[model samples]
Target chain A: MLSESDLGALAITLKLALLTTLILLLLGTPLAWWMARSRWRFKFLLEAVVALPLVLPPTVLGFYLLVALGPHGPVGGLMESLGGRSLAFTFTGLVIGSVFYSMPFVVQPLQNAFTAVGRRPLEVAATLRASPLDRFFTVAIPLARPGFFTAAVLGFAHTVGEFGVVLMIGGNIPGETQVVSIAIYDHVEGLEYVHAHWLSGGLLLMSFLMLIAVYALNRRFSVVQP
Target chain B: MTIEARFRIDRDDFSLDVDLSVPSRGITALFGPSGCGKTTLLRAIAGLEYHHDGFLKVGDRTWQDSDCFVPPYRRPLGYVFQEASLFAHLTVRRNLEYGIKRVPAAERKVSLQQAIELLGIGHLLERRPARLSGGERQRVAIARSLAVSPRLLLMDEPLAALDVNRKQEILPYIESLHNDLDIPVIYVSHSPDEVARLADHLVLLEAGRVTASGAISDMLTRLDLPLAHGSDAEALIEATVAGHDEAYHLTHLDFTGGRFTVVRKELPVGSAVRLRVAARDVSLTLEWQSGTSILNIFPAIVDEVIADGEARMTVRLMVGGVPMLARITRKSASVLGLKAGKLVYAQAKSVALLS
Candidate 1:
């Protein structure tokens, strides 16, 4: 059986993953849409920036996020100036770190999906008298549903399984910032192999099941497509 | 009412410069070769493709000018792309409702029900676009466009993607649209047969220019135009069903030139129809032969004669007030001394009722 602290960690992990995925979808949709539609000659430069987090080590991303969110740093200093404390070791700080760490997982799938929708359907909507915003909601979003499904799953799962960025910023505060991945690490370091096995085995099974669900559902969707 | 359009587009490899005015009724075809900018011209009218130096006026509304440009969705028009670009996510009924819902209630002239009936797509309402055959999809596409109640309709090679059978299946519905609806239509196509059958007015496009524009009958018989010299050169005639003879199982069609008897058609008597007379199906003779098996013979005057491909010569003939073409051998032209002002009898081997 898992300890009380381990259960608390699992609860915090789910909370953090859910909040992160919601924010990512909110921010990534328009960004991914722009990446899919922009024809600017220098657009590749922005594409490279979005792809940077995918190639960089998690520790490398965590370090910069830590500094930028420290007391004297830009984002934290602004928060302090607004009558708030720096977010360096808070749960909000973990969320911010998980956001950057999981950005590529959320944005890239959405971008690919939007690109696959092509200009033809949008043009058809325009001819049908739909305005730009209406087309975005009705034609573009509905057509890119598979991309959103994959992005949401990946963003949520990757944030849940993350360790380095959470450790760098969250500082393993047991009831607040401490999550499942870090709790498993603590069990392993203490030679409590039973706790480690329980947490690790659960995460492995959950992730595999989520991926299987995605593959199975996406296959059905593709078969319906012309 | 009339549509006046002028557009000048200059791209790296292609440029289209056209200035034209066409009456705002019936089908006005933009006829040309594949790369001759016909589709670009139609897209320009739809505002899907914008030309910086352009001017367009449909009826009394200025769609584009030096200062203002109406975006596609804002324009009072409907456009059908070459492929049936229906939304795969929607059922046929929803696809038809998409544009009509965006339109204001008072401004909607074509009801959703009318469009469904006109295109014969009423039976396909609940099915997704993916489940439709090519002909069914195109009919749905047409109905969707009409549901918007546009003042003008633009179709860009709408049948170019269909198989021969599908095209045959869908073309009559298009004719019904022209007959049942009063909205002006601009049809873009390279197929001479479609133009000869459907177009009341023709705008001949060549290398991004309007070489000529006139009534369909005149355009088809103008000897200098490339349309008159091709293997598919055809003369269009407006006729009314005069009567039907049950004894011979034939129908009599009376046109400006003379009466033509063809195999019986189901069309009611006195119904106006269009007919296609292929140049190759017409033979010119100095005298009418009483022993011939041909059913249509008209006394005509040779309006002009020009050398066609290889050993063939094309002769322009005026029957009553209508002009027709006959492709005869140059040897026969010389032997019969066929020239401008020479009288001849035209024997039509076939007269195809287009509508």
Candidate 2:
């Protein structure tokens, strides 16, 4: 049986993942759309920056974010001057770390999907008197639905399974920042093999189910256009 | 009213430069071979291809000029692409309604029901585009554009993507649009047959320039143009139904030259129709021949005779002020002593009833 602290950590982990996935979707959509459509010569620079997280070590990202959110750092200094405490080791700091860590997971799929949606549909829509914004909502978004599903699933799963970034930013406080990975780590450290086995197995099974669900659903829903 | 346009487009390998003025009624076909910039001209008229040195005035509205440019969505025009670019996620009904919803209430002139009926696509309303064949998809595309009630319609080789049978199936729908609607259509086509059957005005483009622009009747028969010399060369005759003889299952048609005997049709008397007489089907004689099987014969004067190849010649004839063409053997031409301004009788082997 899992301890009370294990349950708390599991709840906190799911909560963090849900919020982080939601935030990534909201912020990454416009950025991905611009990346897909813009004809700027230096677009590759932004593309490389967004893809950095995919190849980057989570600890490196966590280390920079920790400093940025720590007191005397730029962001933390600004917060301090504005009558707020430093953000490091807080839930908000954890969310920020998770967003940066899982951003490419959400943005890359969307960018590919948007690019795959060639300009013909949009041009046809325009000739039919649909404005630019109207075409995006009615034509583009609906056509890229499979990408949305893949993004949401990958973003949620990646954020949920994260360990290093959270360790660097979160203080592993109970009912606040402690998550499933940290809980398993603590159990193993304390020689609690049974608890570690339960948490680790549960995480593995849940992630596998998520990926299966996404792939099956994606295959079922056709993009409807060639 | 007239539509006038001047566009100058500079590209890496090709360029288009033209100044054109065409009447703002019926169908005007941009007829050319491939890569002659006919599609580019159509796009410019629709405001799809933005040219810095461009001028367009349709009726009284200035869509593009030196100081002003209207985007494609704002212009009162509908454009059909080479492919049926229907939204895959939407049903046929929704696709048809997409343009209708964009136009303001006061500007919606063609109702959705009318467009649906015109294209004969009511059975396809609930189906998605993926479920339709190429011909049905094109029909939906045409209907969708018509439902917008555009002041002008631009079609860039709409049937170019379909097969021969599919084109035949869709041609009647396109033909019905001109007869039933008052909107002016600028159609781009590479097929001379399509231009002959559909367009009232013809704009011949070559190497990104206008070689000739005039009525289809004159353009098809003008020996100076390529259309007059090809194996597909045919003269268009505007005739009206005079009478039908039930005894022989034939119809009598009256044109500028004389009366024609053709297979009986459902068209009523006094209704306007078009006739296509191929150059190869016509043979010229010095005087009218009697007791001949050919019933459609007219007294014509040879206007010009040009060598088609080493073996044959193409003769341009004036049949009572209307132009007609004849392709005869060079040996026969010399044997009959055919020449310019010589009186002759042109016997049409057969005349095809168009529209």
> Which candidate should be chosen as best, given TM-score against the real structure?
1
What digit string (tens of lDDT, one per residue) describes model 2 on residues A1-226?
8889999999998999899989988888888899999999999999999999888898999999999999978998799899998889899999999999999999998888888887889989999998999989999988888888899999999998899999998978988899999999999999999999999999999999999999888887764554
Worst 10 residues of 2 chain B by lDDT: B42-51
Give the DockQ (2 decimals) of all models: 0.79, 0.77
Clashes of 1: 0
Predicted candidate 2 versus true structure: per-residue lDDT over B1-355, tens digit per residue: 9999999999999999999999999999999999999998998888877899999999999989999999999998988899999998899999999999999999998999999999999999999899999999999999999999999999999999999999999999888888899999999999888898899999989989998899998889888888899998999999999999999999999998899999899999999899999999999888889989999999999999999889999899999999999999999999999989899999999999988
TM-score of candidate 1 versus the correct structure, residues matched by position: 0.97
Worst 10 residues of 2 chain A by lDDT: A217-226
State TM-scores per candidate.
0.97, 0.97
* Residue ranges of candidate 2 with Cα displaced over 4 Å: none
Q: Write the per-residue lDDT of candidate 1 for residues A37-134, one digit (tens) a residue.
A: 99989999988888888888888888888898989889999999999999988999999999888998999999999999999889889988999999
Which CAPRI level is candidate 1?
medium
